[model samples]
Target: MASEKTDKSRLRRDLLRTRAALPEGDVPVNGHALARHALQLPELTGAHTVAAYVSVGREPSTREVLEGLRERGVRVLLPVLLPDDDLDWAAYEGRDHLVPAGRGLLEPDGPRLGPEAVLAADAVLLPGLAVDRRGLRLGRGGGSYDRVLERLTRAGSRAALVVLLYDGEVLAQVPAEPHDRAVHAVVTPSGTTRFPAL
Candidate 1:
């Protein structure tokens, strides 16, 4: 398992590096296109309440997408990462409500909800370094998302788990561990692709 994890980590890093080398305008454009496609998905379109992450560093920014959702009357929940790597939830009012969170990430300024609130979300938009056809995801190694996803699954929500990525970042396979949280779909600039069951 350790070896597998190491391999996955290396693969994820390589993909991230490649993506980073791409032009900045291209990255955001691709991300926006992907977000547009993802919004068309039934699970996403039908969702009244959605949970999304604030983009930081090289992660694709969801500011425009979130704003569009807000215009459509969708309730957005943004993740607040705690010191212990646990996630708290806060309602997204708009760009004005965002404040700098840990690790240079932006989060909503408001009361936070516990794990149960996350479970009630109609869909979740996740960030990742890379994802495979089997739905296994390679995150930033913090394990924060993995922990939260485990709690959501255990709660029987089965919320649509979608990871946003550049087209080249989606891989045919990725190393996986038993504890890794598998996503249900991947959204790229090209389109939204559903992954096979893990």
Candidate 2:
């Protein structure tokens, strides 16, 4: 287990370094395109509720996509990271509902919802440092999303777990720890890429 953690740490560090070296503008542009594409996926179409993350740093900015979802009559839920690193969800009525949570991340200001509410979401848009063809995800080391995904999976629902990234950030392979959650698909500026059959 220790060796596995070490391997994941090294791989995560390397991937972060590689992502940091990418051209800045390319990241946001790709992220925006990917978010737009995700909205078109069958998993998202007609889904009344969706869970999305607020992009920070190189993570894709889903603000426009969320607003677009609202315009299409889909209710959006944004995750708020708590002190214990667990996710508390809130409804995203519009851009004005966002308030800085911490570390420059923004979240909706409203009633907090439980994990069940998140599980009810038809699609969950995840943020990650890197994702591989097998759907292994390398997160920012917080492990919050990993835990949340595990909870969602254990609930017996096949909520689509989609990771947004720049085209280059999708790696050939990513070291996975026992606690790491595999994403269902990866989206980039070019198009949506489904993962290997799980």
Candidate 3:
């Protein structure tokens, strides 16, 4: 456990440095490509409900993707962070419904649909620093998505877990912990990579 933590900490620091060093103009272009790639995923297109987040900072922006999904008549659910860092879901009604929240993140301002709302989603978009060959994801270590994934598992939800990443963030390997869950796929700017089910 101690070694895994140490490895993740180092990997997080290194990935953040690389993301921070990216040219400012690259964010929007990559965001656009991310949206395009996400739409190309058959799971997303067939999904009636998609649980996603409002990408902040250098994280590949989901602003375009969120709006795009809504335009396609998909029921888009955005996360509302609880004070304890657990996530609740809310319906997305375009960018107007989003309000600034903690951690400089934007969340839906509608009624909270409870954390378990994600169980009904056909797809779930996760935020992460990097994902490895085996589909292990390295999040920011906040333990937020861990709880979300755990909730989905406990309820036996079949949501297609997905993550958005820059092309380079897809590393060859990353430290995996026992409690960690593997995502089904990741949509990078270049294209989408699917991990075979374990």
Highest lDDT: give the candidate number: 3
Tens digits of per-residue lDDT for model 2, 6-77: 877887787778776767786667666876797888878868888988776656667667878888999889
lDDT of 3 at 149: 93
The sequence of per-residue lDDT tens digits that candidate 1 reaches over residues 1-198 is 879978977887787788678777775777678778877888778999899987766677677678878888999999988888988899999999999976798999988887567887889998988888888888888888888888887888878888888777787888888888778898887888897645
Error of 3 at 137 (Å): 0.7
Worst 10 residues of 2 by lDDT: 55-64
- TM-scores for all candidates: the values are 0.94, 0.90, 0.98
lDDT of 3 at 155: 95
Best-to-worst lDDT order = 3, 1, 2
Query: Any idea what lDDT model 3 has?
Result: 0.92
Write down the lDDT of every candidate, Cα atoms only: 0.82, 0.80, 0.92
Compare the candidates by TM-score and give the number of the best one: 3
Segments in model 1 whose C-alpha atoms lie over 4 Å from true places: none
Which residue pairs show backbone clashes in model 2? none
130-194: candidate 3 lDDT, tens digit per residue: 99998989999999999999999999888999999999999999998999889999999999999
Model 3 TM-score relative to the real fold: 0.98
Error of 3 at 174 (Å): 0.4
